[model samples]
Target chain A: MASVETTRSGGDTGLPDLVLRGMTLGYLGWMVVLPIIALGFQSLVAGPQAFLDAVLDPQAVHALKLTVVTALVMVVINVVMGTATAWVLVRYEFPGKKVMNALIDLPFAVPTVVTGLMLVLLYGPSSVLGTILGTYGFSVIYSQPGIVLALLFVSYPFVIRSVQPVLLELDRAEEEAAATMGASGWLTFWRVTLPTLAPAIFTGAALSFGRALGEFGSVILVAGNQPMKTKTTPLYVFGEIESGNKQGAMAVSLVLLALSLGVLISLNLYQRRWSLEDGK
Target chain B: MKTRVQGLAFFFLALGVGLVAGCGGSSGPDASGDVIKLGAYSVVREAFHDALIPAFQEHWKQKTGRVVRFEESYNASGAQARAIASGFDADVAILSHTGDMNQLVEAKRVSPDWAKNPTGGIVTHSVVVIGHREGNPKAIADWSDLAKPGVGVLYPDPKTSGGARWNINAIYGSAYLASKAAGGGTPDLAAVADLLKRVQANVVNMDASGRQSMSSFSERGIGDAVVTYENEILLRKREGKPIEYVVPEATLLIESPAAVVDSSVEKHKNREVATEFLAFLTSVEGQKILASYGFRPVDQTSPLLPEFPKPAKLFTMADLGGWDEVQTAVYGPKGLWTSIFSDQGK
Candidate 1:
């Protein structure tokens, strides 16, 4: 029995496991790490002036501003929708609950390009709904609203998945006790419920915002890639590269990387803080 | 009982390892130096599949006696430039224009001057006014006909697509020519500027696919006209869409350049074979093949194939400041075209 157990140890399979880990690390290094390092080094060679010029360029600045603004709106929408989704899934029992439960995972299964295409089909100028919307001059495909929709499509899953576990783990007895005390549902939700979910919601929104900010493929397809308006930072990075301005491209890339890092760090800190409070 | 379970576990572990090893076998091509990677923009990719690949492979095989293979990545010019700049390797990069090649130069990945590099003589393609609908309902005759009130336009985003830049330049060049034919005696590029702004007002939205722009125009009622490569119009017409071509009295040319990647060839030390592939592109047989694929050949007296349509007003890079200037000026933000037309999106 001891020999059998010992054979299962990582040490016993050291060569293959080490090779597997090395392969994973190498794959990640080529795909992610090496390019980031090269890009960072390239940006550094351009120095501060190029960075400032890229960041302060009116068009890059506008695109970056729009990316942040849309991401914030998406974060708000996702937090509300995702929290409600988690709460309902945790607390409610209804017909088709199992099917409805399966649907939350659908966004994960669906490619974002499909999501953008679906939005275009449903709300674009050609669709039945789109034509009606078009008559009112409410074009959705190539406007600020389209960016919002695309961001929402990509980032929606993050918040729901993030909050569901915390909501499920939450004690029902506390809510019942509040109901017994004659507290109103809204009051109970506000005083007893919100505080517990706030940290999770925050973490999810940060993830959503980070994902939303960096989205390229789907957003560009729908957003018309309008300079100074629909052009997100990734799209801006694309334009800079096309224009033969590698320094400009690298410089803007670093800004996006820095912003993403900031969100990830804050989310990490919030998770740690919330876990400690939960422990106490 | 424990020994039986352990034996079963070990069997499963070996099975898993075997599966991974089998998958790992064919996952990547030979990492040995024998294989050559060629990265290109889209049409060359199609041409390689259709025309160049077999010839190049045969030619390389006859010479080296070792099997030579090419790895290719193809995309729109801007997107591909990003991949190359970020380190996708290519022994050669055959692209639509010199703007993207200049990007590699600007990044110091290539020799400072790509124009001076060994490659030759006019590779031909054409663009024309891809009109509103069958029988030309809008009757868009000249370049200025796009300005007819209530006539919207659909085209690829210029910032993101090389073909769209050619499309933009076509209209702009014609407008400039009209300014000259009026005999004030010079092409006023600014007229191209004004024309673009007015046309910009009518653009419902810019899309990335030239075909998608046409499809959107037809399906979504997105626009009245799309300016795209004439080959695109022919390609689409074959699919049985109701479409017509408007050969504007004035037109700009599309020349697809083929070049060996200086650094990539040096690294691979396959300059002889790489140069042969380019030679194949400029060869009479290659030009003949290009013509078959609907490229209007630059060799005028070489006899016309009956199927291909002749361009009305054929022009080339020599007419527009060439690729270096186009990269610095038009595709560059400070360039007249970008400074003017790009503002509409904002």
Candidate 2:
């Protein structure tokens, strides 16, 4: 009876379990690993020298720079605004609070392409606001600012969703204790609250940054797709494919994949370290 | 008790498998017995959906007393072509230009003799035209006008859009002809490249396809003028959208091609019908349908649509060394477009 129980629960049910593990591994190998491997292989088709040239091309470099710059700006905006929003929803009670909280997730619910269209409708050249801005020689649509705007909308909810739960579970006693010691509100938030919330905030920022890195649909519409000027890496990859240069596309895509994976791994490690410190 | 738990787990697993099996039964190709799969460029969606498909369906039913289904997918012409080449399993492809169709031919999905077919390999035609606001506020008249310093032009990126490739070629072709006529010598490549550079400088938005770029012009009112297919302008005007367009004096006539994907049709055992469908598109009735939808009929025998004004200097892809040469010189790796924008600042 003990042996049967062990086999059923802890010991792996032998042959069937082995088969199931194999199936799961095979499925992932087929779906995820194979495509990435294929891309890597295809990138090497024109030899390593050609692959390097394709990736290091002047236009490719500009696109990468633009993608990174926009994504970083988006991260900054999302982290600040998203944290403030989550803080308000968790700490303060205001009219339409529930609706406001619900609205924060609208970016996640709507398609990315539609987000671009909405931005254009609100900020395009002919709209009242857009016209006003244009009259002042400050264009938003079809520029770097437009790319950042699209990225901000698509990635706004990531940080908020990540930090909300942690904020909810945080103890308020420490803050009250700080207040009793005659600590100012800002001082309490900076010293007592921020340190505790740092890990969650970091985790959320990393997620938003990672998502913004791969943002294509929304940015494609707003970026104006000017080569070397407003074009992003994904758009460049798309252009390469359209021009029948699949090898170039694959090489650039592999670079993006590696960057995203590196960030993800770093984020995990960082979160783990912070959580470990908190335990002590 | 442990055995009972294991037994329950097994029961749930089997139930899940059964449910999955039930859901998957209707998803195979069994139901596609009489379906004609079409993968086409996005710009032709309206014409295909409204007139062409229904007419084809009626024609098939009347001839064979059997109903047929059309499974269609539409996207930018380059994307659609790439999809078919990469095994999207499309039986027919109606693409925007010869470049995309030639991509399929290079992949052997289409026959090499595609150009010599009954349809003249050219299925329907339109010239690149300038679309402006209702009152022609910008007063954009010709290709040269688009390059003016303050003019904001909207066109799709040549990399992803078949239509944009044609538009780019038209601009370059026009410049070449103008230069040739002025000097009475070989067409100057530098002059053509310079014109393209100027036009690119004035471009405010480069969307993925012609339709999307037109939307930026008409809907967002982003650009002062737009370069797009003439038929699109006509189609929009017919829909009561306030748009006016002009046919440049010297413009490239876009020859949109339609062909049967030989391998896909052969694999699906629908080659005869696919060939018949291609033939149908060039038929008198099909040409009429195309004309009604604003496409200049490939069948020149058909009466011309009065709304489609004749350009003083019209040219085909043949006038500019066909798709392969044009693609190589203008849009190939390290081509003219790449060189022109290579030093552009961030």
Candidate 3:
């Protein structure tokens, strides 16, 4: 309580400080808290039995399972591939390296629906690769694989963007020292570089997974939107709304909101702990 | 600390007030209440936007001394209906199916006697027709041909799309009629369910709308044939796209309904203008405009365009016990369509 009083009084606080604090709180309340509160009340409006029925519906359960499984898979793929991409961009010099680095953010720039369309065009049944795979009864688009592919495209830049700056700021002296001690490239990367990169990689992977959990546009376009098959939670919520089931839609939406909020809180806590460790 | 908490509470209270103000305060009458909002389904979007609206404006201007301005929003029928029912403030709603209008009627957003008008609550009509690649390579002439091996069928999902529900009912109803004609007995639900199952097996993907499914067939080359609205096929043909379409014998007639949303019109106090707009939609001149855009006019006696081909056997929603019974029987829990695709059906 003393520290809080000192923070308010000890600084060169002015009207701008008060005004800015008010503005920030106003924006946060109006945009974030209000909508979430509205959704919360709407979900509970139908009472406990209806809420349970919506959450435990067979299609809802299957969609939740699919959403989680696909997001987890996306986290793993992005952590590895995105880290590799960042490492290559930072370390290697190639003819088109600059273009490739810029191209890494294209997924973020292009619309999700366009990404889904491109994936379906390239790997759907119309393509040569798709045809060969279809012969073996392995389909890409309109299946679980397509959902993962779309998630990978959208979440591609997360880990790369997170790890790139860390890699750039990292001192390479330790890796050079390890090299002089006769450590192999893989050994140096494993024992030295990866340890330092772990925190950024995990943070970015968590963010990517959180994003995948709420993905709807690209997943709906490519995953065929088959209930209890490739339908994700967001798509299920959409279906519920379109079918005039507002209670069911609100319930599923609250589920997604809770999951994303959990991710955000955990990430915030992780960052706070790391900052405390760095301060000490 | 207590002051800060009070500030936070005041902020939230202000936010709640702002939300209510933002939503509720916009719909009051301006200087003059000559503006009417029209919410419609996507299949009729181009027609309403391009052909019908301009003509209606001209007609209204000629009929009345003052000009009427319209604000329109279009999407899936069910989506539009939900928006209107949940307070989107649409004065008149032109939807793709009776199911959506029925939902609004049930919600009291629309008047119960909306159908007591001239055209029986429907304004536009079409049949579930098939669109195929140029030259008709699959030789698909009827619904049963889609069930043949190696034929990939494309249609939207019934769960989200009103048009898709009509398409599915067309398939089921056509099969039931065929079976009944052969035996002179009532439709066997088992046989009808089996036919639907066979067609479901060839489904490449159930897109969200008839327009989307048509694009997946025509542009993406995903499926061999698409079940879509007859007007969509005619519109594409008019566009000189290298596509051919056939209306199957014994197909379900798609009856799209229009209504003056009672609550919205009453709120806006534009009930007279909204009613006029709806009546104009089913008028002879309006029917002609709809025909130009490939929609079969709701007035059966109205002259159809020369380019529009009539289906040999057209069945109404009544043939299959209307949308409620059909939705329950085919798309409901333990519904045959759901069971045919997955084990999730009760």
Q: Indicate which candidate wins on TM-score.
A: 2
Model 1 CAPRI rating: acceptable
RMSD of 2: 5.2
Q: Note the Cα lDDT for every prediction shown.
A: 0.74, 0.85, 0.86
- lDDT (Cα, 0-100) at A178 in candidate 1: 99
Candidate 3 lDDT by residue in tens digits, A77-179: 8999989999999988899998998898899998999989889988898888889999999999988999999999999999999899899888999999999
The digit string of per-residue lDDT tens for model 2 on B160-244 reads: 8888888889998888778887878777778788888999999998888788888878877778889988889878876888578
By DockQ rank, best first, the candidates go: 2, 1, 3
Q: DockQ, in order, for the candidates?
A: 0.34, 0.64, 0.33
Q: Cα lDDT of model 3 overall?
A: 0.86
Off by over 4 Å in 2: A1-34, A168-183, A276-280, B1-35, B56-69, B299-308
Ranking under lDDT, best-scoring first? 3, 2, 1
Residue-level lDDT of model 3, residues B1-346, one tens digit each, is 9999999999999999999999787765566438889999998888889988888888778888667888889899888988888889999999988888998998899988999987898998888888877788889999999999999899998878988888888998888777888778766778888888888878888898888988888888898899998888878876787468888978888888999999998888889888988998888888888887788877665454334456788888897778888888888756878666555452
> Candidate 2: how close is chain B to the reference, as a TM-score?
0.90
TM-score of chain A of each: 0.87, 0.92, 0.93
Largest DockQ belongs to which candidate?
Answer: 2
How well does each candidate superpose onto the true structure, as a TM-score? 0.79, 0.87, 0.85
lDDT of 2 at B55: 92
